[model samples]
Target chain A: MTVTDEYLSNNADYAAEFSGPLPLPPSRNVAVLACMDARLDVYRILGLKDGEAHVIRNAGGVVTDDEIRSLAISQRLLGTKEIILIHHTDCGMLTFSDDDFKRGIQDEIGIKPTWSAEAFPDLEEDVRQSLRRIENNPFVTKTESLRGFVFDVATGKLNEVTAS
Target chain B: MTVTDEYLSNNADYAAEFSGPLPLPPSRNVAVLACMDARLDVYRILGLKDGEAHVIRNAGGVVTDDEIRSLAISQRLLGTKEIILIHHTDCGMLTFSDDDFKRGIQDEIGIKPTWSAEAFPDLEEDVRQSLRRIENNPFVTKTESLRGFVFDVATGKLNEVTAS
Candidate 1:
């Protein structure tokens, strides 16, 4: 069976015990932008209950225009005030350079992607960079608290990254 | 204290019983793209163990250049083959149009966002739209299975969206 089918079977169990239809808005008034790493389960790590916060994730959890778009919708329409950004140790984005990745794709497909892969060598700096992106953006203005962190895959501890 | 601080406290508890780092690549060879919804916990809904699948999320669970970037990275770098797209019921994306959302932002701030808000009128259609986007993308070539679903909030069941 495909893993999707396996997950679908799991979904049946989830539905059997499910008590949901939570309110539309986030209960905690928070939004989290995190990496799409298989290891970083944002909900359990942050002790988030269902419907507590909006969770937005991507490859590196970097703040691209799409992230900005998500945050705008989160804060503007949904009343989410706090924003949390999470990058982690041993991220795939750190393993390769943007040019090399795009070049590899171009070599294979004969066309290069125009978008930035947003690979960063420094984790903390990228965390700070994401923080600054939100801080400086015009659309995401409803912010009472904004912070960034690096999740250590080994210990599963989130280390805060202060802006330098 | 901010909610961020509260979550930080929770992180300490998570770290107390945490396990060592798993391998970087997903064990299940799967990647999930879902909406940045407060209610749908993708891991729980799919019964995913840590380090199993990469979960990428954003507003509307729609496909854009950023998603293509992430999916390309997932397929190429991490070796994920199956792609799952999820959009839940009662989505905020259905509440408004892109034009209205942009206009609202424009009225609040003099400068309107150049990016598409990606609001969709129909859930199943959008799920198909997301699926088609992935099927047709040049960068995300390594796919063995691709499917889309609309998660029902009240029942907590994933209703599969077949291509029409």
Candidate 2:
């Protein structure tokens, strides 16, 4: 069996106890933009139940244009009003420079990608920058309640980045 | 106190039990792209542990340019070799057209976004398209193991989308 088949069978076990008619709009009226790091469990870290908030993740949790597109729908169409941007320590994004990665790709693939990796040096700075990106976007509806955070993967502690 | 403060306190409670030296490379050598829908638990649905797979989520799990960048990093920088793209039934992407959403944004903010919402009418077709996208990208390594699935929100079952 493939991994998906295993998941299909495993989901049968999860489905046995599944009780969901979960609402479309999250209960907290919030959306979380976090990193795709496996160590950070946004649900367990924030005590979010199944339907409490929309969790949007990418490589570094950077607020890219696509993320803004998602947040646009999250706020205008789905009624999510608050935005939480979370980055983490020890991120893979911190490990590489954009140019180096791009050049490496050029070497391997014979073509350079137009898109950026959006890697950053400092975690807290990236969190602040992401918050500012959301706050400054005209498409995003709920900007005033934006909060940025950096979760330490080692200690599992979340530290809020104060707005500058 | 803000919701973030509350989350910090809650995380303190969780951090008390934190035991992680989770490796950088996911044990499964896999990455999953799924939706930002609140109801879908990618981990529980796929039975992934903390250090097993990178989960890259966005609005519709669409294979955006940013997603391709992330996958490039996931394969070249990190050690992830396999990818699973999952969209779901009853998705918010199915709820609105790009033009409608852009018009709404223009009405509210006096500006039209160049970015498409990446919305689609059909789920399985979207999954197949995303799989094809990964397979076609030259920057992405390990294209052989790419798979796609549609997770049912109501039933908690994953139905694999067979590649054409």
Candidate 3:
């Protein structure tokens, strides 16, 4: 069976015990932007219950225009005031440079992507960079508490990254 | 304490019972793109263990350049082959139009966002839209299986959206 089918079978069990149809807005008034790393389970790490917070994730958890779009929607329409950004140790984003990645794709496909691959060499600096992007953005104005962290994959611990 | 502080406290407990770092690549070879809805816990819904599948999310669970970037990275760098797209019931994206959301932001701040708010009128159609976007994208070329679904909030079941 395809892995999707295997997960579909798992869903039958999830549905049997499911109690949902919660309110549309996030109960915790928070939104989390995190990396799409397989190891970082944002819900359990933050002790978040279902319907508590909006969880937005991507490759590096970097703040691109789309992330700004998601954050704006979270804060303005949904009443989410707090924003949390999570980048992890040993991230794929840190493993390669943007130019090299795009060049590799170009060599294969004969066309380069116009968008930034958003690879970073440093973790904490990138976390701070994400924090600053939100801080300076015009659309995401409803944030009351904004912070960033680096999640250690080995210990499953979140270490706060302060803006330098 | 702020909610962030409360979550930080929870992190301590998570770390207490934490395990060592798993491999960087997803074990399941799958990547799921879902909504940043408060209710849908993508990991539990899909029965994904930590280090199994990469989960990428955003406001509407829609595909954009950022998602293409993430999926490309997932397929090329991390070796994920299957792509699953999920949009849930009672989505906020269904509540408004792109024009109205942008107009409200424009009225509040003199500068309107240049990005699309990505509001949609229908759920299943949008799911298909996301699927088609992935199919059409040039960067994300490593897919072996691609499917889209709408997750029912009340029943906690995922009903597949077949191409029409």
Tens-digit lDDT track of model 1 for B1-164:
99999999999999999987999999999999999999989999999999999999999999999999999999999999999999999999999999999999999988989999999999999999999998998999999999999999999999999987
Report the C-alpha lDDT of model 2 over B112-162, residue by residue, as the tens digit.
999998889999999999988888888897654788889888878778898
lDDT agreement with native, every candidate: 0.96, 0.84, 0.95
Fnat of every candidate, listed in order: 0.93, 0.60, 0.84
Find the candidate with the highest lDDT and give its number.
Answer: 1
The per-prediction i-RMS, to one decimal, reads 0.5, 1.4, 0.6
How do the residues A1-72 of candidate 3 rate in per-residue lDDT, one tens digit apiece?
899999999999999999978999999999999999999899999999999999999999999999999999
Q: Write the per-residue lDDT of candidate 1 for residues A63-143, one digit (tens) a residue.
A: 999999999999989999999999999999899999999999999999999999999999999999999998999999899
Candidate 2 chain A least-lDDT 10 residues? A1-10
DockQ of each: 0.94, 0.69, 0.90
Q: List the candidate 2 regions with Cα displacement exceeding 4 Å.
A: A1-5
List of clashing residue pairs for candidate 3: none
Give TM-score, chain B, model 1: 0.99
